[model samples]
Target: MSPVCLIARDEWRALLRNRAGLLASGLLVLLVLVASFTSLERRAAIEADRERYQASVDEQFDQQPDRHPHRMVHYGQFVFRPIAPLAFFDTGVDSYTGNTIFLEGHRQNSANFAEARQSSLLMRFGQLTPAFVLQTLAPLLLIFLGFASISRERERGTLRLMAAQGVAARQVMLGKLLAHGVIALIIGLPAFLVLSGFAATGAAGWATVLPMIAGYAAWLLLWAVLSVVVSGLFHRSRDALAILIGVWMVGVILLPRVLPVMAEQRTQLDTNIETEIALHRKLADIGDSHDPEDPYFNDFREQVLDEYGVESIEDLPVQYAGLVSIEGERLTTGIYADSAARSSARENAQNALVHDFSIISPLIAIRQLSMTLAGSDLASHYDFLQQTEAFRYNFVQRLNRMQAELIPGIGGEDPRISAEYWQEIPRFHYQAPSPFSRPSDLIWPAAVLLGWLVALSALAAWASNRLERNLR
Candidate 1:
């Protein structure tokens, strides 16, 4: 075998001989498996519960008794965002972003009943999913296993012995890299297996699963290479361990926590109360239909009259009040859409600001990749909200059209539309945003991860050269 291969073999043997390192690795693998099973069960339960709730709400909407179309508008409908199959691996922002929305006419409601609000305090720490394990805990494990990869050799003088035996510095570095890189792959094997199983079962598409696996693989390998490279930089194993731990703390723990706060402060988002108040103000600015002399409504009435080629509201073939309701819905919906877009923009800006720091903390990059691939990110939630709004507008408009066209010649204060019309309103069928719908969302983070790996590999080469000089 080649010298590099022999050195790698010896390194693996050394790791095997270290009982504590072996035990730690064993426990992490076990933890990953447990996390996988637990996450799968939890996801299934959530999916079932949401499905049941959606069915119940749909049935109730269909079962409403004969009533005025306007009355039905206020009754509203509930739409629950379906959980994505890969959400089992990384819950992401789903726990915080509520899945269900109450959609009604002339108004847009915020999603309510988030898991975070209902769960215990322990949830604040984070979920125990495969992504969490691989992203956060896995790096720490790599540090523990390889922090002394070269520093220990220096401390014990084996590095010099190897040098005297004619082993090249590049060979030694390559051997360490090979050993730890393989170990990194081994560490991620359980998660990869679970992902493959999900794909085999047709739970997630291969397109998404493959990229997710690649991003994480790079993430683990980056840490392993970083550990080996840093280890070579120090003369003492303790110093190398300390440095690696600090890097892990900053990149994995500290920055992930701090950057979000910084991002939030950097770009302030409007609060719910503030948004509602603004919406109400905008609605009020558009004069109420109830006011007989309101100019906006007067002009709207004239438009309806001209459209129907009638002289006044009373002569129109359809209920004039229904026409007003339709117009009101259109106006309000337009305003609400504008508000939603602004809010989405602000959120995207905040997230972009945070993502910009991914260069400093590759954890951000992997996290972005994981959540986007799983379809549990903020963008996915926003897509759900947008689709629900569209459904709401269509459902409400159908009822408005029903009241205008079917109500008997208009004069009754409480005109009723046939109950059969309720069935005509469509149910909300959410088309989950394609995981690859926006390439930039995946590409940037992925590039960051791959870039980190490449940069670390370059650092390893430089460190190898330094090690050789020290030995000479």
Candidate 2:
């Protein structure tokens, strides 16, 4: 048999005989299976709840009695963002972002009822999902299984004996790497299968599912290589294990928490209260629709008369007050949207700063990537808000038009449009972007994982060369 093959076979036998290794590997397999089942079930529950809420909201919107258009505007509909199919694999920032938003005219509401706000602080410990298992815990398990691979051989003086028998250092290192890499693959396989099954059954797109699997695979292989390299460099098995564990703690636990705090501190986003106050101030400057003699309304009144060629608003073919209300709403809605965009941009900047730290910690990178792919990240939340805002604008304008065209002909002191106008208004339909459209967000994380793999591979090579010299 080839020298590398012989070494690999021997190493595999050694791993099997080590009770600790067998027990750790078995436990990891069990954890993966459990994580897959629980995450899938949790994801299904969330999706069902959102769907049911959306149906309830839609039904309520359809059942409103005849009232002033502005009354319906204040009574405003609620829209719930749906969970993405791959969210089962990684809950991501879903817990942080609000799932429900209230839509109304002349007001931009912040998404309310985020899970983070509702949950106890323990939620920050981390959510249990297949992505979480693979990104954070799986690496630690690989380190525990492989951190003693080469170090133990050296401590027992068997490495020197192998060199005396003419077995090359490269051969031993390669063999150890092969064995640990296979074990890492085994630990990650069930989650991959579950994700693939989701994709096959049309729960998620292949675009997201494939990249997610590849990203996770790269992440696990990165830890496997690092573990093997550390084990090769250390003279004692205990030293290797300690160093690897410290590395895992800092990379996986410490940075994900610390960076977000730093990002929030550095960016200093405006509170929702501040945002609402600023919006109110802006609307006040835009002139009230109810005030007949307001300058802005006076100018708008003239423009409508000029367009319709009438001497007085009451003589015009359409209801001048409703047209003014529509124009006023348009102005207020535009200002609100601009304010929302500014706030969203600020939040995104904060998130980007956190993502920059992902370069230092692959766990953050993978977490962001997984969230982005699952459509549960901040970006997805923002997308839902923007779409809902657009829907609110369209729905309100349709009602305003009904008031303008239909209320005048009905001719009452308080002319109300028929309830039939509400039925003509389109319901909100959220169009989530495909994973490919948002691939750039994942690129940095993917690059971080690739960088870790390359750096560790080089370190492994350097360690192998040193081992060869030490043996000589």
Candidate 3:
């Protein structure tokens, strides 16, 4: 073995000989394992309950007695977003964001029954999962173990002894980095195996899962290198420990919460009530189809008459009221869709502003990456909302089409469709699009993480050089 490798081995032996280091490492690994098993169990229970609820809703809708198509539209359907397999490892924003969306005609509902909303305030502190452990706690464990990688030796005159024994200063630094880096890998291995076990069960796609493993591995290494460099920067291990803890508090706890608030303040989106009120005003301006003398409806009625090759509404084959209902629905849907688009745009801008500061905190990058890879990000939830909206439009319009064709032309207010027709409308089946479909979503945050890795590597090299100068 090379001198650096020999030194690295000795450093590892020293850490192993330290009982406090061993206890801390053991406690962290135990915490990770328990968190993994508990989180997985929680996810499974949630998935089962959601599936049961969805099945019940589907059965109830299909079994409803023959009713007016418009009534059915107003009755609405409850659609559940499927839980992603990787979510067990990283709950992401899933708990905070609701999974059940109510799809009714004329209005869009927010996803409801969010766990965070229902749970005690402690939920906001973040859930117990592998991602949480590694992102928030593993770094602390590493800091505790490695803060003295160099400073302890420097304090005891061991550095001079090593130099007299012909060990280069940079070699000693590289040895410390390697020793801590290996410990980091050892710390992360259990979580990695947990993910692999998830992959083995075919619960998650290997495409995303493998990259998730890489991302987390990189995350841990980032902290490992960071801690080692901080050790080199400080002459005392206590000083190094204090600084690393401050960094942990700021990046892991403070900034994630603060940045989102700042981003929201900077790019505020309209609230649901405000959007609805605005929509009502816009719909009123479009002119009511029910008013006989309203120019908009008169023109629409004339156009319908022209299309049907008839001189009056009474002479038309289809119900005129049904046609008007269809037109009204189109108008409202258009406005609602525009408002939804605007709200989504503003929310996305806010998220972008927060993500732009990935340089300031790699935790932002890792949290985003884990959520994206796990398929529980805000984008995925929004995808579900968009799909539900489209399905709602199609199902409601189909009902309207039935009313137009089957109802009496003049008096179709109480027209009913066959109960079988409800079954034909199709239950909401989520496509669960591949995480890779939006590569760009994962790419930038990943690039930021990569940038952190590169910057840390540079910092390590600089620290090594500084160690050499101090030795001279």
Candidate 4:
């Protein structure tokens, strides 16, 4: 066997002899399995419940008794965002961002019933998903296994003995990296297998699942290189362990938590109440439709009259009030669109700030890549909101059109449209944006992870050179 292979085999045998380390590895694998099965079950239950509720609500909307078309506008529709198949592997921000939206006329309601709002503070720590296991816990396990890789050899004088026996320092470093990198890949195997299962079932595509596996594999390999390099730099195994633990704590845990707060402070997003107040103020700037003498409505009325070749509102074939409702809806929808854009921009800016600092903390990078691939990121939620808004506009306009054309000739104060018209209204069906819809979102985070691996490789080279000099 080659020197590197021999060294790696010895290291593996040592790991097997250490009962505590062996047990820890077994437990981590078990945790991945438990998290995988439970997450799949949980995702299935939530999806089934949402599907049932959606069908029930859609049925109820169709069965409504005969009523004024305008009355149906107020009744509204509820649309639930369907969970993506890969979301079972990584819930991402789905737990915090609500998945259902209530669509009504003249008002844009925010998504509600998020678990974060209802659950305790402990929820912020994160759920036990496959992504969580690979991203957070897997690195710590690599540190434990490899922190003593080279330092223990130096402490016992085996490194010098190897040098005298013609073992090159580069060979030792490569051997250590080979052993730990293979172990890192092994640690991540369960998660990758889970993802492959999702792809095989047609819940997720191999195109997306392949890249997700690559990003996470890069993440684990980065930690493995860091652990072995740090071990080589220190003269004592305890010193290596202390330094690795501190680095893990800061990069994996502290930076992720702190950077979000910093991002929020730097780019302030409007609160719900503040956004509502701004929307109302903007609406006020446009004259009310209820006022007959209001300049905005008067101008709108004249336009409608001109289009139909009628000089007066009453001379028009369509019901004047229904026309007014349609015009009012158009004006309000413009304001809502502006508000939604501003809100989306602010939230994206906050995320961008966090992403910019991903170099120092790779957790953020992997997280962005993982969530984006899984279709459970902030962008996905925003896409859902936009889809709902478009649906709302189309449905409301259909009702307004019905009111204008069908109600004018009817003579009663409470003129009613046929109940059959309600049955014809289409139900909202959301189509999730493709994961690659924005190429930059996927590219940047994946680049960050690969960059970490490159830098660590350079560091490993430097550590190996230093070890050679020390032995001389």
- Provide TM-scores for the models: 0.98, 0.96, 0.96, 0.98
State residue 185's C-alpha deviation in candidate 4, in Å: 0.8
Model 1 Cα lDDT, one tens digit per residue, 240-274: 99999999999999998998899889889999899
Q: Cα deviation in Å at residue 462, candidate 2? A: 1.0
Ranking by lDDT: 4, 1, 3, 2
RMSD of candidates 1 onward, in order: 1.3, 1.6, 1.8, 1.2
TM-score of 3: 0.96
Superposition error at 110 for model 2 (Å): 1.6
TM-score of 4: 0.98
lDDT of 4 by residue, 278-397 (tens): 998988888775455677787788888899998888898988878888888899999999988988888898889899999899899999999999999999998888889999999998
lDDT of candidate 3 over 1-472, digit per residue (tens): 9888988898889988999989989988998999999998998898899899999999999999988777888888999988988888998888988999888776767788888888888877788888989999898888888888888889999988888888887888888888888889999999999988888888877888899989998988888888888888889999999999999999888898899999989988777788878988998887875454567788889999999999999898987867887887788889888888998899899989898887798899998889999988888888888898899888778877777787673245466767988898888899877778888778987898899889988887888788888887
lDDT minimum window of 10 residues, candidate 1: 408-417
- What does the lDDT come to for candidate 3? 0.86
Q: TM-score winner between 2 and 4, please give it.
A: 4
lDDT per residue as tens, model 2, 333-382 = 88988887787788888889988887778888888778888887888877
- Residue-level lDDT for 126 in candidate 2: 74
